[model samples]
Target: MGLNSAMATVPTKEKGSDEIDFVRWFSQLEGNLAETLNGVLLRAARPVQVGAASGAQNLASTSAGRLVGWSLREATGTAPGVVRIWDGRDNGGALLACVNLGQGASETQWMAPGGVSFQHGLYVEIITGAGLSDDVEGAVYLGGAE
Candidate 1:
């Protein structure tokens, strides 16, 4: 068999390891992905929400830590970016609970569980300026996962 065909071969040891196709595996190599894009677009909020209006911190609750396994997609054409989430609150302080987006690098992501819980608050804010200026365009997508 040719080199390419050799790598394409799959084994029958299905019980030993979780079988993943080479092409599909490469497609979702960034974390146990449920979405596209080769980077992270979601995660547990910063124990709070990062909002607009110049540093309006939305404090997170205890359950905020439960934010994991989140996934993200892309909303191309929306310049600067758009943060869409399900809003919720806890006590006097509120949290973004589930968040989909990168912190610094494009490939960085953090997610929250869906169906079982929500992203605490549905506060959608995008701050792209001097210090943190990365237009939320092209590769910008958000959704619930895990």
Candidate 2:
């Protein structure tokens, strides 16, 4: 299941314990604990990294996946290139992020503490600029669900 679907609404505790409903408090705490555990497990899944290539790279084959984080470096080219991340099997889907590399070598890293879920998949690609042999190298951090 997707990260959001797998999660449940945790019960909330009372603002003040005037009445001191012990049973209700306990239930709320238990629910909170389960939610925390689920989040930890989803985020802790092994991460897969995809390298720079001519075309878009499919980081995860699973239909549903999450993007935990990613790190990339761009350099050694006539001009800077852009690193585009998408939530799909290719760049045809929704755009997650687009990092424009500096004229000189530069690096970037993106992370979602709670993780970002995608229904399609995760993809990354380097779009070179003006006869630029830009080498945009990066690794995508994938986790949750698939």
Candidate 3:
């Protein structure tokens, strides 16, 4: 069964406490706990390679949520390249983040700091400079309630 299904099996019981409804309190607590746990698990999901390109490429499109983090790796053995994350369909929109990869095989990771969130429902763009012999591979991490 799924996590939500398992969480649904939790029993709610009523308890007398002066003028308070302990059953409702417990139910709400369980729901909050489950949601928190689910968020953590979602953030821990494996990264997926959006795409690889020699020039500018549209890496991925989000589903109306804040991008929390990302991991990028240069798959080709050519010169280093720059990867930029945009907030729109093309690279002409607002720039959200950028990462510089070293020459040859190299990797890097990024995470949004506290009190910062990327725009919702936007597209991430990856761009590389000249001398790219092979395509670049990378993945992005997204979070927030959608």
> In candidate 2, what are the lDDT values of residues 14-87, reduced to their tens digit?
64323445556666565544323335544254445555545535454446666767766665655666777788
Segments in model 1 whose C-alpha atoms lie over 4 Å from true places: 1-93, 97-104, 108-116, 119-121, 137-146
Clashing pairs in 3: none
lDDT of 1 by residue, 63-111 (tens): 2223332233222323333343334443323433333454432233444
Please identify which of the two predictions, 1 or 2, would achieve the higher lDDT against the true structure: 2
TM-scores, each model vs. reference: 0.24, 0.56, 0.55
* Tens digits of per-residue lDDT for model 3, 60-136: 55433456666666666667767777776667667887777766555655455332254544465556446642455
Models sorted by TM-score, best on top = 2, 3, 1
lDDT measured at residue 107 in model 3 versus the true structure, 0 to 100: 61
TM-score winner between 1 and 2, please give it: 2
lDDT of 3 at 74: 69
Which runs of model 2 end up more than 4 angstroms from their true locations? 1-45, 53-58, 131-133
